[model samples]
Target: MALISDNDPIYELLDKWHEDDEYEKILEKVDEIPMEERSNKLWFRKISALNNLKRYDEAREEIAKLSPRCTETADIGRLFYMMGYIYDQKNCEFKAIECYRRRAEIDPSWDECDEWVNDSLGYAKKDMDRAYNAFSRFFPDYAEKNQNAAEKKTVEEPDILPYISAMGSSFMSSNLGVKLPLDQPFFKCSEEDKPKVVSFLTDRMHITDLKSLQQDFGRNRLAPLTSNILHIIETGEEPPLDKLNAQQLTHYEASKLLLGKMKEFIPEGGLAAWDYSDMLAIARFMYSVDMLTNTEIMQTYLFANDECKRLFKSWEEFTHSLTIGAFYNAFTRDTSYNINQSAKFAINVGLFCMQTYPGIEWLGEIKE
Candidate 1:
């Protein structure tokens, strides 16, 4: 057999982790490898993962590090686009506009920037209206005096999604055998209310059972390392084993043992099996019950790459118009048992599903 390129496994695992939404793992795994083995593509992916995980502070610092090292126009375009996205999420209106404008200069056909531009403008209008309403209530002449001024002034909207999105820590806790309350609207609740809400849910959710579950879960202390081996199996790639430890070697051996079984679930068409509701249900159930191991989850991701893109071409398209079955499949695939995130993801997916399949309810327990 021909010799395997050292970079092959790096790209393969990177793609696998990206596909599975395991962002932090990408950085950790990359860091474990020698510095000389790193590349611009790896750095770009690290930045992308950080953004997706909502680590904006680290992502911005990384962007600074990558800016000088980058050479390709395509990489630069993606960098600017991601920077614009981070700015938008940070509620930096003008800065976001500037980044998006810069991105447009490079890739004019990028329509998401235009949509975000409009979103920023709409948010500005709402902020002005809200502020005026509050101030005018206290000062009657305030509205008349500042109506023109308000139109001229910039408006800033708080980053609602950051507060609302299911945080990674929540997932980690769930993975550690802390049974989360699926019915709780923790993510949707205001930041000030999350602590009290969580306290309330703790007793009500019966998380005391964690004492027993903890015995089997073992705190997942080795989870970080074990997870990497799982990714290797899922992506069907073999990294340099000489660099790994005894524990990781054991995990790798276990993953290989399960690889064949994992492939059985990944259908040829992957996400295109929209009509295959049975398969979707099977996948969801397997994930929920922990039957689909980490490697198996990767197998599905590997299988879905081309098909998912075809089904939901853009981030906007997927966010506003994903199918119910598809949403469940993605949500349960690798949540670390964080049902709140699963529920929140389902709600977002349902927004678009309702537009297409009016009043449709794919999940019996979870409603849009």
Candidate 2:
């Protein structure tokens, strides 16, 4: 009552508020408080509260008043942080981003704050809700960097002949019009196992020729499975499907990819494709396709260290062995890739080839 003094100069400012709307009165009382005092934090907090209360105009006015003082003080820095939080708390994500940016400009070390702000913007972009899930990989810079590494590595990989010399083909078809990729490794392995396969791919296989293979044979389909299933299979006598949380999803994805790749070679009604209902059939188709196109590869081939090349070469012969191998697994007994995961992997490679290379003849090959 004393602060709302009967003779204070700002007293009328409060009286005028008695007849104004209740929220407006509260906001006015908030205005009468001194900007510089022990209560500076309190003042800014009220301003943030006002902004959340939908008094954005009032909030801007308060910000304008503080911007000069807010030039570099830790107090001002904290106020901006609250301002950003207010925006985010209100679900005004862009406004939140703007606040975070403002804070970052005030202090670049505010990058920690920037991470979340950009993340919010990524989610709040709200343009493609159905594709919003894919936006989870919002680390766009990371993807670009990885892809650039892949391109450079593709170019540096060694020649194709030495590696192919190691690959087993029954009889030579000279002028082999077949197209095999020079860069993409053909062994059937999951991406988790890719690091282990990298030695083989770089030393003996090629990634650059991926584009060429798709040109000759067809394109690869991308059925991206989320979990890593390769480790379990290599260590266990039987393929371990149940150990993974996403085993079922990975299984289905492998099936989809295998089937999708086969569709490229056989099209919709092709007799050869129809013959392969089980994963083994699909796997064989992939191997046959690789054999047919082995000579046409265009990318640089890597000479695997003798041991690694030998392993990959032996892989080609026994690659067919894993079909009955995976089929015996409890999860794959009825599943498609059970017959031969390697063959299925080959088909996936074909799909990857197609997607990466873009087949000119593969137009309209995907089934409706």
Candidate 3:
């Protein structure tokens, strides 16, 4: 809405296309506008037409293309809502719920978004419960026994349980019940080769020093840069571009472009979740490389686990926050990053974990 004007003739044409069910004509009209010139309304119309025509893949492609271009909160929120609809139609219930949850966070007044989220969540819960019940039928006391144990385990070593979903995409790809493997060949190195394994794992996870990474979580290095960009988005007051060097200008512009979507989707405790996830991920790699002993690794996981429990209420909420953090991490580090692909990958990982590991308490319980 912030991006459209009633006087725009293209919108008038789009409305006529909608009325006549001329979805193809809507696409054609939208395509006629140059990419740079296309407004949010144009992108919305194009995606709507694609959806109506049952071209879900093309609709998703268009959504991915439009994601990075959105600058207004209303536009970003609507984009997520549209994405939710597409996923709902495709029967990807978890992904749809994730998108709807994001839309709700961005614009809480859109009460319908909350309804969609609850509906999808309700359906997902029934499916998961059915699966659990089927499994329990084979082992009559399994659910009751494990449910109690899981609750007790949560209070004792909260880190291990919470870190399961943070396993993210890697956990999804492995055999369901198996512990996630480290880089396989390196995982079996001789004691003399331990240093090589350590070096390799550290480089792979981009971890320079484990202790430093843990301590640096409190640092707000991006605060000033983010504040400047937020100011630009809120008030049309532009900072002098000529004063910034080439790299600074690039970061400034990229932050300006991404800040809107970031603010809309990044939930409460999102940044902390991201940091803790990274720490746990790196700790796993460290354990494999002999950089951390079993005791050290458990200590790391426990600390992160406690923080995550304090910050997020459930596995879905945690993963959603983690994805937002991943998006910010990707784009901020490399302006050319494909955030759309990153988001899809992250969501898929969360969905797989939820479906595969239904016994995990965090996945089952909906804590307030």
Candidate 4:
């Protein structure tokens, strides 16, 4: 299907309609396009509008009509997902499970399908054993692949554990009179002790209230600066300095300076590794405060580990990236501060983590 570019006026209008909760307008606009001329994107938007408006019967009808026309796996998977969503909303657990499972079968990489299937099974009070047996029988290769991946992860857990300590140690060691037990692994703290550790770090970080912290962390304030720097790096074309005000120009210059230093140590991944590390730290903190679950924390850790290992060859490179990232973030917030002092402090934190932690070798391999 020849999809409409997002910049197309009609597409933007449709997006505006979606954002404004004008579902009826979306249906009307979609219908204005000849049925044969409509793209899969338009059809998906129409179906989404119907689903959002709680017109489940109409949504299912649209799905049924669209199903046979879907030649691409992505479109077919989406159709099944929409159908599953409609069934779930109507409390038809069995139908929802069937749709979700079909979606998963067609696109094994669609993790949400598996999540919906599990949710539907729970709602139906179906035995997980039976579900697993059925799944294994149909997708033996996929099942075995996942099993092998899980085994590989289990084997690598210990190697990754030390990195977690290194990641969190800068925050832990900053607090005076707060120390982790010397003999015990940092992550092996008792449930009762976990809150204490979190509390100490939160206090040190001056996070007195959850509401404020959540508001601050909800969006990356550095995104604009980061984007500008990345654009300059990729294209070798500078943005119009005259267009930026004094404050923005200052920030742009700082971003370039920090990015230059970052390139010295980080061979790849650039700001992405820093973003993942930030997420990892926040996820751990959130888990401690009951804002996130242990499962979510582990998922965040695994994802961060994968990306960081792919980007960096050794712990020193990762540390340098983190240090520059920290300095960039802080300097952007308060450019009045001495830049050299701030950079030194951030670098010292990374150095402290490497030196103070027992198993954190500076040149340790970031295992693949």
Model 2 quality (TM-score): 0.25
- Model 3, 1-368: lDDT tens per residue? 14445468878888988999999999998787777677777788899999999999899899898888888888898998888788667654556666766776677777896688667655544543443333224222333444544333232344344344345325422422224343331233356655654555555444555575465444523334455566678798987887764345545554555555456444455455556655565555566556666677667766666666776765545655665555455545532333344444445544444444444445233234
Predicted structure with the largest TM-score when compared to the true one: 3
Q: Rank the candidates by TM-score, best first.
A: 3, 4, 1, 2
lDDT of 3 at 41: 75
lDDT tens per residue, model 4, 250-340: 4555456455434544335454445555554545555555655566556556666775677776454555556556556554553232344
| Candidate 1 Cα deviation (angstroms), residue 95 | 1.7
Residue 79's lDDT within candidate 2 is 68
For residues 1-60, write the lDDT of model 1, one tens digit per residue: 332354676778788888998888998986776656567677777788888899998999
Evaluate model 3: give its lDDT.
0.58
- lDDT of the candidates, in the order given: 0.45, 0.36, 0.58, 0.58
Ranking 1 against 3 by TM-score, winner: 3
Find the 10 residues in a row with the least total lDDT in model 1: 155-164
lDDT of 4 at 228: 63
